[model samples]
Target: MTTTCLVVMGVSGSGKSTVARELADRLGWQMAEADEFHPEANIAKMRAGTPLTDDDREPWLRKLRDWITEHDEHGEDTVVACSALKRRYRDLLRESTARVRFVHLSGTGQVIGDRLAERSDHFMPPGLLGSQFDALEPLADDEDGTAVDVSGTPEQITDTALRALGLQEDAR
Candidate 1:
């Protein structure tokens, strides 16, 4: 059987972690946060209020792709929270994967900026929200995913994503 993986993606502060965690828990799937895969240098760069270039992101994306490969080889369903803001990035993730899908957590800059401002512990400063929005590319028609508006609670958003992805809720 092919392992199925879902990348819960969006710009910073779009509730990617919250929704991804909830969805993963509800589905009984392993959850991975993209930030955890970043090298210290990348974290430091973001902490310095500089947006990461594609060159900077290549290694990080490769690490994520490796995670997908690992889980697929083990036949485990996994959900990952990542800021896959570009089509090429998503394409890179999909390459040679078993069954990968994306769920885009999308919302307006104002909403995401407000959330970022309210966060005190994250490395991504609210000042960088604009760059994230500027670089965001909506999921293309050929992409195997759907975009969910983050106007609702995390649980609600997770439920919507589950329905959209045709995943069944955990019975327990």
Candidate 2:
């Protein structure tokens, strides 16, 4: 069987982690949180309400890419949660040897902002939600991915993504 790597992507508060975790569990794939790849400095900068520059994100992105590659080499299906906000960042992820696909979790800023405001444990400050939205570019037509609106619960979003990606049957 071919291995697949699903990148659950969106801005802060778009339910990337929640949906990705559910998807990975359903699919019996390894799951990773992109934030775990961030260096202390990057996390500190974001915690300070500073938007990360491309330079600051390069190493972090590379680490995620390496994880994808590692899983691919093991012929493992994997799911990862990441704020692949920009097209370039997504492109870097697609460089992995595995069959890389993305699920873009999309929601209105107000919706996401409300979520951010309610969450207390995350390192990403609620104020950075605006910057995240600004940086986000929707998945283009040519991209190997689908965009699922975040208007539903996490389970609904995960089901939508699986159906959109033609993985619903596989998950069952």
Candidate 3:
């Protein structure tokens, strides 16, 4: 059977980590946060309020793709929380061997910025929220993914994503 990788994606502060963790726990899949794949330099840049250029993201995206492929080789389904803001970035991720899909956690910039302002543990700053939204390209019709609104509670959003993605019944 082909392994599946659900990439919970969106601009930063869109609750990607919260929703991805819920999905992974409910589905009994291994989970990873995209921040974990970033090199120290990337993290530092974001922390310093500089948006990452595509060149800075290329190697990081490749690392994520490789991670998916490695787990797929082991027949393990996975979930990842990532700020896959651009269509090209998503396209690169789809190059993995796993049947990659996305769940876009989407909301207005105000909402996400509010959440980011309250977050204290992440490396990304609230000031960078604008840059994230500026770069985000919503899921295209041709993409194998669904977009979930972030207006609701985390559980509500996760439920919506599962239903939209046709994975509700598979939840544990």
Candidate 4:
């Protein structure tokens, strides 16, 4: 198989990490958490209840792009969970690698807030959810991606994404 990568993207509290982790395990691919690539400054901003500006996020996005390129050159199948909330962010990813496709997780702000509150530990607070929605530019319908509803169980969500990406169980 060619080196392909799937970007599992969504706003905070949308289960991006959980779904992406399971998907990577099932697909036997290298999993990259976009959060891990964030510079300490960005993490501090979120922790302080301040949403990151586009300028603040640009470097982080570049890091993700560079990682994708490096891993692609190594012929590894990869999955990344990123809050690529804008068209421009997605464009940067496209420019970095030709093998990337996105799976966007979407859910109601209330649902996301509940999830965030229930979670034990995460930098992003529920207070940032409104800001996230304010800045979010949902993936366009014509975009080459899968839009999965995240209102159900994480397992069900992962199965949908796996089927959408054609990731098979045996690959794990």
Q: Where does candidate 4 stray beyond 4 Å?
A: 168-171
Residue-wise lDDT of candidate 3 within 95-131, one digit each (tens)?
9999999999989888888899999998999988888
Worst 10 residues of 2 by lDDT: 1-10
- Checking candidate 3 for backbone clashes, the offending pairs are none
Give candidate 4's whole-model lDDT: 0.86
What is the clash count of model 4?
A: 0
Q: State the C-alpha lDDT per candidate.
A: 0.90, 0.93, 0.93, 0.86
lDDT of candidate 1 over 1-172, digit per residue (tens)? 8888889999999999999889888888888998999999999999999999999998899999999888888888889999999999998888736688999999998898889889998999999999998999999999999999999999889888888887855512
Name the candidate, 2 or 4, with the larger TM-score value: 2
In Å, residue 60's CA in model 4 sits off its true spot by 0.3
Across 1-172, the per-residue lDDT of candidate 2 in tens digits comes to 5579999999999999999999999999999999999999999999999999999998899999999999999999999999998999989988888888999999999899998999999999999988888888999999999999999999999999999999999884
Order of models, best lDDT first: 3, 2, 1, 4
Cα deviation of 77 in candidate 1 (Å)?
Answer: 0.6
Sort the predicted structures by TM-score, highest score first.
3, 2, 1, 4
User: Which scores higher on TM-score, 1 or 4?
Assistant: 1
- Worst 10 contiguous positions by lDDT, candidate 4: 163-172
Provide the clashing-pair count of each candidate structure: 0, 0, 0, 0
